[model samples]
Target: MTSTVYAPHDHHTCITAALANAKTLCESRGARLTPVRRRVLELVWQNHKPTGAYELLPQLAQDGFNSAPPTVYRALDFLLELGLIHRISSLNAFIGCAHPGQEHTTGFFICRLCGNALELSPERMQDVNTRLAEELGIVIEEQTIELSGLCPSCQLAATTAKEDIA
Candidate 1:
């Protein structure tokens, strides 16, 4: 199966926007958006991809944040509670949510060719879960729907490279 791969954007803008939204939500909820939490969130959103907590630590250390694993874990837990991020169980990594501060079950479209992970919104999740429930009488409690195939850009590049070789 194939899906359109996305291009890189202003990652700085994305990280900033996500952090801003998170802060707004925390403030509205009377929750403390602590510095460690904010930095962790920023790091997660910075990549626009799933990141393991261990990998995230070095970035924090480099930034002069001498936080232990537990600190990062707490931050991740807070983000998960607020629906600002979701853990990709299969990969043991976390990805930033497209829409934060909303209730939604996470679904990912993970590309095998390039390892790009994309979030599926509520409408798409409903369509898929509805079919599963209707056909198999199975309610998806937690789903990690990672479609493994060549993403669009990778496919195009492969084809072009093949043509050139020929």
Candidate 2:
């Protein structure tokens, strides 16, 4: 079964692991993870929800960072280049990558009700991409699939509300 971000889990542990993995990957790649870049990454992993640059500006400002548009943009660009984060084009927001130090296409299942985003596993992603390539006869270059709908919890709530009213 695919893991859902909305499902209860130890998010603190997930965040810690992701950060550590990023640090290790950066060090091995000889990338300088500056203080601002590190903090921006931390904020991106603050929750399961994808965050927009504007949403992060105030937080950075409160933390005494420059919080300017260029600063945030540069950090975001660096993270994207390093594959540390994924941008949800549909929502204009960014989310921390669940898996780092690997090259794999990511598929996002975004919850419309709660705005939570979950990354599909690499295995599942590969299967889907393979199918698409075979069916379309096109070589895939870049992939970022974004699907939006109600999550399981939201579906249950909607059903319960309907039953109650009926």
Candidate 3:
């Protein structure tokens, strides 16, 4: 498991590990992580913040890659297909999946202030799925529970700002 996104840690290691996992997974699946796709993954892993396709356009353009909307969209879609990334529907942004090779319950806690997101994949989520499926008698295809609020740092900042005004 990776370190909590809220905690301070060596983030370069996160990017490195994610890339290695993606490569291994692609090799196993007989799929390729092409240049644009790889770069897009790298950019998404730059931080815990969710990345929008448009936000990546200029970055890719600066690196002499085609920054067309379709190119980036296709790359993002490809990564999503390989389970290398997750899309935040509310934000219309994408984040790197901590667990890349498994079919697991997924959720996200997005910071309203900073837009940083922490992925949550708790075992209990599976229980919830089970209850819903068994009780409601319906099959569960996919689901994501998203909660939004200020992160710890943002909460502290808001409190301090309030105190300063008093």
Best by TM-score: 2
Regions of model 1 farther than 4 Å from truth: 1-5
Ranking by lDDT: 3, 2, 1
lDDT of 2 by residue, 1-166 (tens): 1364788787887778778877898999999988889989999988888999988899999999999999999999999989899899988999998877678888989888888889888888999889999999989998769888998889999999999999
Q: Which stretches of candidate 3 lie over 4 Å from their true place?
A: 134-138
**Clashes (N, CA, C under 3 Å) per candidate:** 0, 0, 0
The 0-to-1 C-alpha lDDT of every candidate, in the order given, reads 0.79, 0.87, 0.90
Model 3 vs. true fold: TM: 0.90
Worst 10 residues of 1 by lDDT: 1-10
Instruction: Give lDDT tens digits, candidate 3, residues 53-154.
Output: 999999999999999999999999999988999999888999999989787888889989988898876566788889999999999997868999998889
What's the CA error at residue 80 for candidate 1, in Å? 1.0
Query: 98, model 2: CA deviation in Å?
Result: 0.9
User: To one decimal, what is the Cα RMSD in angstroms of model 3 from the true structure?
Assistant: 1.8
Q: For candidate 1, lDDT tens digit of each residue in 120-157? A: 76678888888989999886776667555676777898
TM-score on alpha carbons, each prediction? 0.88, 0.93, 0.90
Cα TM-score of candidate 1:
0.88
Q: Candidate 2 has what TM-score?
A: 0.93
